[model samples]
Structures are given as structure tokens and as C-alpha cells.
Target: MFDVPLMKKNGSLFAGIALLLGAFAGNARAEEMSLQQAVEIALQNNAELQAFRDEKGLREAGRIRAGLLPNPSLEVSLESGALTGNSGENAFSVGVSQEFLLAGKREKRVALAQKELEVYRWQLTDRERLLRLDAKSRFYQVLLAVRKLKLTEGAIELNRHLYQVAKERLAAGDIPELELNLVQVELARSEGARSAALEGLLASRAELSLLLGGKEVEPALPTGSLEAGGAVKQAQAELLRLAQERRPDLMALRAEAEKGSAELSLAKAEGIPNLTAGLGLKRDTTAVEVAGLEGKDTSYTVGLTLSMPIPLFDKNQPGLRESSARRDSAGNRLAAAASRVEREVAAAYASLSNAEQVLSLYFRNIMPQMEENLKLTREAYQLGEVPVLTVFEEQKKYLEVNQGYLDALYQRQLALFKLEAAAAVELTGGVQ
Candidate 1:
């Protein structure tokens, strides 16, 4: 009987544990989606990236078709001649000829086409990275706006409580009417601020949706360890290395320069003359003393014929110079981009340091003092040592710290993104 009762009790206990575990797992799933998932979805469906893909495909097709040999020409002729020999005699000839390229011009064309293919491929990579960065920037904007709206709502709630307290105090003749009115006015202002921030948050969300392949996909609000989230700890050398190795814009510049080099090669090869070889078939009739009336004769001739373009009028020197200039311009652009990237890295680093310092002040110094003052003023008011207005002032100070903290978070994230855009690397939390 004891074993039976214990077994039933154990079953109920196990069931209770199972229910708690299930609820916890369900909450975890509903709360957050990692940034990596968002980035992957954007990449697969992003419209701008898809456009680059199409552009690259077009370039590849053009390169392939460009390698083919030039088509040969066909020639046909009809001639009539009369040679008088005592009486009247006539001779007629008809012939057809076909020509084929004898020069190795096709091989030279193939070389130039291979070079062009490299340029377009790099251009495609550069556009893809820009699109990814754009998406990340917009996503952060939405996050920042939402954070601000929450801060505003929190402020409004604090003001509402203060207003209620002021009303009670004024009715009891403990506080003046003007003090109560001041709290009411502050409450109204907080409400207005919250409404405006809510509108801005919605607008930011809409902007993010447009960039996400023109579709709206709502993301769950994210929360992280804010202490280290604002740390932009990447070294300058690391950023420079990433810029050199993976930056899409720089790669595009290099690709264009290579394409220019290919163009130069083609221009030089154009100076070489192309030769065409021909073969012909002919028939001669009415040969004197050798053939009778209605005699049929067939003659075939195999000859090496060369037809080449004259290099006398144009030597392609001007074209060669233009291509060289383009190559030089591309190099200059690449250098400028490198310098600009370094400057951007420096600027972002400075901003990050400043934001971190300010954030520290609010977290470590301002918030602590504000919270202590609020408690002290409230206790004093209850003891008839301080007025209700004093407590309300302390409460407003705390709300100000909250707003400042939210603003600092937004600024820090923006600085990080600017650094990422310069280094051409994906942010740690911005993969999606």
C-alpha cells in the first residue's frame, strides 16, 4: 500500500516538472531571432543584389560571345568575253569562292575576353556587400527608435505617478496648486514625447521593410549585455587588413582597371592584319579543237589567297592612349578609396570612445545619484521635512538619465556601423 501511494505521488511530481519546462522553452523561442538569420534572408531575397547578379550574367555572356572567330565572306562572279577568230566566237565563265580567316586573331580575342570577365565578377561582389551594409544600417535605426520610445513611455509613467501624488498633497493643504499644475504639465509633455517617438519608431520599421526585398518582416526586439555591446574593440590594423582583403568597392575598382588592361591588349592586337584564304570552282566551255558540240568540262582550282585589312589609315594609337588613361584613373581612384577608408576608421574610433565615456557617466555616476536623491526626497516629504515639489524634481532627474542612456545606445551602434562600412566587414551582431 505504501509503494502504490508513492508511485502515484511521483507521477504527479514528474508531470508538474514537465509543464514548467515546456513553458520555459516556449517563451525562449518566442523572444528573439539571431541577427545572422535576418542577414541570410535579406541576402537571398534582396532586390539590389539580384540586379547585380543579372548584370554579371550579362557581362559573362558578352565575354563568351566575344571569343568567337569572325565570320568569312563568300564571293560569286559572272563574266562574258567574245574573242573574234575569223568568224564569231564567245567564251563565258562563272565562279564562286569562299574565304576563311587564316590569322590567329581568334586566339587574341579570347585572351582579351577572359580579362573582361574578371572585372565584372569583382563588381558583382562589391554591390553585394553594399546591400548587406545598407540593410544592417536600417535595422539598427529601427532598434534605436524602439529603445527611445520605450524610454519615453517609462518617463510618462513616472510623471503620471508624481501628478497623482501632487494632487493628493494639494488636497491635504500640504502642497501648493502651482506645484500640482507643474506635475500635470510635465505629464502632458511626456505623453506628447512618447507619441512622437512612437511615430518615429514606426517610420523606421517601415523603412527597414522596404529594404528587405520590399516586404515587411517584423523582427523581435533584441536585448543584449549592454555593458560590452558598445565596445568597438577592433584594432586599426585589423580593419585595414579587412579593407584590403574583402572590401567590395575596392575590388570593383581593381576589376575596372583590369578591364582597361584587357582593352589595351585588344587595341594593340588590332594592329595585326587579318588574312583570309579562299578556294574556288569553275567551268570552261567551248574550247576550240579540243571539245565537240555539247561537250561538258569541269575544272577545280585550289589556291592560297590572302585578304588583309590595311593598317595604313589607322594605327589605333589614340585608342591605346585612351585605354592607358583609364587604367591610370582606376589606380588613382583605388588609392583615394584606401585613404578615405583609413580616415573613416579613425573617425568612427573617436566617436566610439566618446560615446563609451558618456555612457559610463550616465550608468556609473548620474543614474546612481539620481536614484538615491529620489528615495531621499520621497522619505523626507513623508516625514514633513521636504516638499512634494522636491520629490517630483528628483524623479524628473532620474527620467532624464534614462533618456540619456537610450540616446547613448543609439549613437554607439551608429558609430559601430560606420566603422563597419569603412572596414567592409560585417558587424558581429548584424549578420542577419
Candidate 2:
């Protein structure tokens, strides 16, 4: 005869072993990382961000080049009359000349380069801002997956415990085979759900690893929650003001507009032709015949010369026109960017407001009531005052309600992230 109590104990032991094995297999090499740590890692290691940082060197080089003086040119010439049988009659000259930039062209070029560097700096900051937002979003997704996996594990345990109860009752002839069969079915379903949840967790972890620039042999486990932070009491007007002052992309555009102005000044300066000044030493040797006497005469002279372009037809008209057009275009772009910032701030604020209300409703009403109902239903089931189907239905309801609550939490957190990114300001504390 099969001993029901011994068989039940063995089944419980086997289930425990299987769960432990599954856990070990899933997280064999997992390393726990916090949300802040993940964001830091991404900022430090992201290939694209590093590439943007390298561009600062090029901008700095341009600034250096703008401040440099042109190299002086050296000229040497010799003239001989050897073909005319007068080798002694020769002339040689050596000269050096430097073309000096006029009308503050060099200063304006340096200013333009500096403005360009400022623009690049702001652009790099904007990239970092966006990268932080992406990392936070991906981290929250991993956290949500972790929560689901735990929820499924809890459900499995609950169903397994009830399965044992049903089995004991069946052995004592206190319940029908149909009731035991129903508990068995619920247990199996919970186990299957756990498998799916685990897969979801793995997928989320893989995505996070890629973002963090990690070639992880096993995915890093995220350590964070989707709990709501303090409420954002600031109005949309305040947020928009903050965005105008803090948004890096907006600042980048402003810098670019300033750069265009500097370029226009440079183009106007360039219309003034540079002056090239030269100093030279000349030596002349001539054979003279006076009163039938042959003699040599040598003379040396030093001369200074200045030269410049006529600027008759090309007074940099094309350059000036291009610079003026660019300046106007930059101004228009800045205005358009400001309008877009207003729109983004308004949209993010609306989403955050809606998410906060939904999350509050779940916390203040649905979650507590669902927990209480589930507790009562389980008690009634154990006391034989309710059918297994009633317990099963209540358990399913608890899972569904909790899942909905988790979704609410995730949405609320995501909305908060988007709001912060749009505003380019931290409204509340970091992720909870």
C-alpha cells in the first residue's frame, strides 16, 4: 500500500529541489547592481558617448589654429649675364615677407572657434542627459521584470501549499478527487507562469547589460524598486522655466547661434585684404670701362616693400552672404527649439499627473481590498466553508490585481523619468 503522508513529503522535497535548481541555473553568475551604479557604468563606458567626448580635442585644435600667425616667406633670386659674355655683371637679392591679418580677422576667427567649442560641449552634455534617461528607463524595466518573477514565485508557493492541504484531505476521505485534481491544476498553472516570468527577467537583464556596455556572461541583476517617489508639486510654468534654463540641447542651439554671429563678424573682417610687408638686401656687381681701364663696381642696398590685394571684384561678398543667412537660420532654429521645449514640458507634465492619480487610486483602494479578500477566501477554504474553486478564483484575482498594481507603479515611474528628462531638472529624489 502507498503511504500517502510519505509520498506527500517526497513530492514537497522534489519540488523544493527543482525550484532551487532553476534558480541556480538562471542566476549562476549574476552580479547585483543598483540603478545609480548602472547609470554611471553606462555614462562611463558607452562607445558613442566616448566618441562625442573625443570631438572636443578637434575643436580645441581649431581654436589653437585660429590664434596662430602665418609663417613668413623667404625669397632669394640671382641674375647673371653669362650668355652675353658678361659673367661679372650679376645681381642677387634675398627677402622675407609676412602677410599680417587686418581688420581683426584673427580675433574674430578665434572667437568663432571658441563659440564652436562651446556648442560642442553643450552637445556632449545633451548626449549624456539622454543616455542617463535611457539607462534609468531600462533599469526600471528590469526592476519590473524582477517583481513579476517574485510574484509568480509566490503564487506557485501558495498553490503548492494548498495542493498539500487538498492531498491530506483526500487521504483522510474528507474531500473528493475532483477537489484534489483542481488544486493540482492550479499548481501546474502557477509553475508554468513562473517559467514565463523567469524568461522575461532574463530578457530584461540582457537589454540592460547591452545598455551598460557590458558583455556579461550572465546578466547583472538590477537592485531597485518601482515605488513612487515624492509628488511633483511644481506647476508647468515652473517646469518650463527650469527647462529653458537647464536643457542642454537648448543651450547647444543658443551656442550655435552665437557661433553664427561670430562667423558673420569674421566674414566681414575677411573682406579687408591682408597687408604683406617685406624687407630685402640686394647686391649688384658690374664691370666698368672708363678711360680704357677695366674695373669692378659692387653696391649693396636694403629695401622695404608693402603689398595688398586690390579687392576689386571679390570683397568676400559670397562669404558675407553665407554668414548672414546662417545667422538668420540659427535664430529661427533657436525660436523653434524653444517652442518645442514648451510642448515637451507640457506633454510630460500631463503624463506624470495622470500616472500619479492612477497609482494613488491603486495604493489607496484596490490593493488593500484585494489583499483582505484573498486572505478571507483562503481562510474559508481551509475551514471547509468554501469550495476549492472559490479559493482558486480568489487567488487568480489577487494575482491579477497585484499585476495591475505593479503596472501602475511602472507607468508612474516611467512618467516621472520622462518628466525629468523633458524638464532637464530633477524634480524629486532619485529612483525609489
Measured against the true structure, the TM-scores of the candidates, in listed sequence, are: 0.78, 0.86
Runs in model 1 deviating more than 4 A are 1-33, 79-108, 216-234, 286-303, 377-397, 427-432
Over 314-376, each residue of candidate 1 has an lDDT whose tens digit, in order, gives 887897898889888988998898787778777877887788788778777776677777767
Model 2 per-residue lDDT tens digits across residues 1-432: 111111223334323433543476574344567777898899998888998898889999999999999999999999998999998799999999999999998999999999999999999989988998899998888778766766787788889889988888789888999999989988999999989987787677777778888674234566655773778988999989989988999999999999999999999999999999999999999999899988989999999999999999999999999999999999999999999999999999999899888877877887777778888887787778899899988888888887887788888888888888888977764321
Q: Which ten residues in a row have the lowest lDDT in candidate 2?
A: 1-10
lDDT of 1 at 193: 90
Number of clashing pairs, model 2?
0
Q: List the residue pairs that clash in candidate 2.
A: none
In order, the Cα lDDT scores of the candidates are: 0.63, 0.82
